[model samples]
Target: MNAPDDTLEFTGGLVARLPEPADFGIALAEGFARRIGDLSRRAGAPAAAARWAARAAFAA
Candidate 1:
């Protein structure tokens, strides 16, 4: 993926494409929302999906 202007360029051609510092929460929330939605469909439980997503997000 192409890195945005504000993102940091790392070694080994890996790019970290993060939103602005002010928008970090919004970005993280959006990702969590999407992941929860996907996991809910597969797991059939919103609470479990959210728990799994929370763990994964925290680990990341």
Candidate 2:
């Protein structure tokens, strides 16, 4: 395993536009939830239906 380094290195010059952090986090969470639901449906287990139901509740 690689040891954790605490040094701050500015190697890459990447411009970030983070005006709305909340919106970004919400979008990220929504994407992750959708992916989980899709994977559950594909797996076709007993919990798959619950996953879809959760998606519907959160989406609406």
Candidate 3:
């Protein structure tokens, strides 16, 4: 479903005003979390991988 115009405008403006350093920190953390998930999957640890992926999605 499409967001209402005012809601879209407010969210778009909010995102546009976020600090660059915060974005960089989030990207770095997300990349590290995803890498952990990948390694866990490669090591045949599905439970660990799933947990890491969930953490990444929740935290990031």
Candidate 4:
């Protein structure tokens, strides 16, 4: 997936090292949110998905 200009890309090699489907899903979700956060910052929108990621971290 393409990361925003402000963010580093999530490399395929790194994703390949994930251990399981659930873990992969969470990582993918978080990574996507991080990219969104970068985009939001650029556009002056709210980082709502980053809040979701924060809640997810507390749930972990």
**Count of backbone collisions in candidate 4:** 0
Task: Please provide, for model 1 over 1-60, each residue's C-alpha lDDT reduced to its tens digit, 9 standing for 90 to 100.
Answer: 343353211112223434456355544554554565567657776766656664455345
Q: Which ten residues in a row have the lowest lDDT in candidate 1?
A: 6-15
lDDT of 2 by residue, 1-60 (tens): 111142112211111222454445444544455565666667774675846644664354
Clashes of each: 0, 0, 0, 0
How does candidate 1 score on lDDT? 0.47
Clash pairs (backbone) in predicted model 4: none
In candidate 2, where is summed lDDT lowest over 10 consecutive residues? Answer: 6-15
User: lDDT, candidate 4, residue 33?
Assistant: 56
lDDT tens digits, residues 1-60, model 3?
A: 222233222124332345765555444554455566667677788875556564665365
> Residue 41's C-alpha lDDT in candidate 1?
59
lDDT of 4 at 4: 28
C-alpha-based local distance difference test score of model 4 = 0.49
Cα error, residue 50 of model 4, in Å, equals 7.0
Q: What is the C-alpha lDDT profile of model 4 across 1-60, one tens digit per residue?
A: 332243223233344455666456646655665655566566765666555544444234
**What's the distance in Å from true for residue 27, model 4?**
0.4
Ranking by TM-score: 3, 2, 4, 1
The lDDT per prediction is 0.47, 0.44, 0.49, 0.49
Error in Å for residue 29 of model 3: 0.3
